[model samples]
Target: MTAAVTTEHREHYLALVGHGDEAAAVDYALGLAECGVSPRDLVLDLIGPTQRRIGDLWARDEWSVAQEHAATHVSEQVVAALAARHRPRPDRGVVVVACVDGEWHALPARLFAEVIRWDGWDVRFLGASVPGPHLVSYLHRHGPDVVAVSCSVPTRLTSAHRVIQAVQDVGVPVLAGGGGFGPGARWGTKLGADRVAADGRAALEVLRSWPLRAVAEVSPLRDSFVSDDEHVLVVKRGAQLVAVAMDRLADRFPAVHGYTAAQREATEYDLGQIVEFLCAGLFVDDVELFRAFVSWLCVVLASRRVPPETVDLVLDVYHDELFDFPRARAHLVAGRRQVPAGRQVAA
Candidate 1:
């Protein structure tokens, strides 16, 4: 029987995890298990939200990378504890859970594996960034009923598409999940996945209702975006783009000019991500892909007390640099519009 996950219980678990007390967090989870809180709810309700909060805290600068890593480590321990307590039923079908290549966020995929195992599926949880060829080799050897791919970062969508196709080539139906797939798994369908789940619970429901003899579709790789040479140009010039943007940033924002080594490196990383996402968006031929990232970038910068206009300035620099590339120019312009105007740093 599933126990009730009251707000009080949730808060207690979150507090323990946030404090980086792995033993305390595990004990708390075990106590809930003793009280009949189902393993599924334990993962989805308590651990899931706590991990998300950790990410949010990091984005807002409320937590350091070390703190975030420590908290995530605790969550993983909690999941292991739950897994030990719940034994799988042998009669259920086998399912393989993994993250797409280049996606280092493994907790969500781990949570899904635990939830599905609790629901009686024999889950093989391949943690973190399984390459396409390796995943295909596993499929040929194990022959699971379904393969669930988890991707958290939008920038890895291109990799996700490759993994999806590779799995289908081996005749395994693929279930795509996570934020990288876009709202409602719109990108998943475009990538030729058999199904898309919003979360673990939803994934379970979809699996339950899935046809027994579903044949994975073999679709040709979509090539409409390949003809756009602008993506290639931006990728080839990425380093130059970052360097020029940094030079222009120093002129526009005094804070950037006086940044410490660590701060300068962080800013450089941020600029690199912008270029990468732009190229990824171009590869997918979806402007919203880049636009959504810009919106999130604005929030992250605002949280760090930096002017959101920094994104606009970067985009402006790109516009001038890529002026001859029509598609790249248009996408940069669209991204610039998504960033709301904020206080400009005095130069």
Candidate 2:
């Protein structure tokens, strides 16, 4: 294809996203394939940007659940049709895409398959929620050049880690991706995975030239806004949580002490453990008091310069006590007094 034709085809793909026209996107991808456009080019030039836009639309609330589902279905059809025309290349190395046991989000994995296919790889996509035994059996059977796992929820991390360990046991390298591996996202390294890709394009680039032999120098997964996990802090409001790594939370809580250390241990359930301890001082089942206590932990104990051992002591004391609303409310009030009156509440 001429440069102009390729560019025009790519633009058509982008236009589909701009208009939220999944059908148009499908037609464009098919048109590129029929016109003898390289699958790699189609993926690198078209599908990557298109999927990013789709994610952005969802993020911005510009696309409803139905619309997002429709878009994903359309993209899947397009990739399936294209794959039917091109068989996996023998020399491009083996790749398998699977979702962790509990994550139903397969669009990311689908887009990635299209990407590796475009890169001339031999890809076997296991779709959403393939169990650990199946994954192990498949890895033992195929011994792919790389294994790419998608996990979209933090709740699924335990399962995802299990999958990674299972795959690694067979000597397969695993690359962990998806929204779950965000800034301050924990357990990626502890799960013993090889690498984590922050975005789709970055993932494709890394896998293409990745070494067959493992690189002994393992490092933390880099995030969009933060590269270092030690600097990220996670804030939990009861069951809801948000994580900010790389000193971003520091700017948000200027008056809070020990922000650095708090950032270091801010993993999922870690805050919950802290909350349980702090709640001991408060009344149980009191939502308002609990929220206030969480806020206090974030701003006071978490923000200030409390020693890690001291903070651990506080959490140890309150890990499990009956609801004491009046006492908890009093502690909340005292905590609030330490901060400026008009600060924003923690999530």
lDDT (CA) for every model shown? 0.84, 0.58
Give me the runs in candidate 1 sitting further than 4 Å from their true place: 216-229, 254-260, 342-347
Q: What is the TM-score of each candidate against the true structure?
A: 0.91, 0.56
Over 120-213, each residue of candidate 1 has an lDDT whose tens digit, in order, gives 8888999999999999999999999989999998789879988987887788888899988888877776777788888778888988888735
The TM-score that candidate 2 achieves is 0.56
Q: Mind giving the per-residue lDDT tens digits that candidate 2 earns over 1-347?
A: 43323556656765665556766776777676677776656655676566666666665556666776666666666677677776765567778999999789887788777777767777789999999998989888877877898887554665776788777767778888876554322345445568777666777777876884664434343222112221111112344321221133344445434545655455434545544433322212223433444454444443344433333333223321212333443443444443343232221
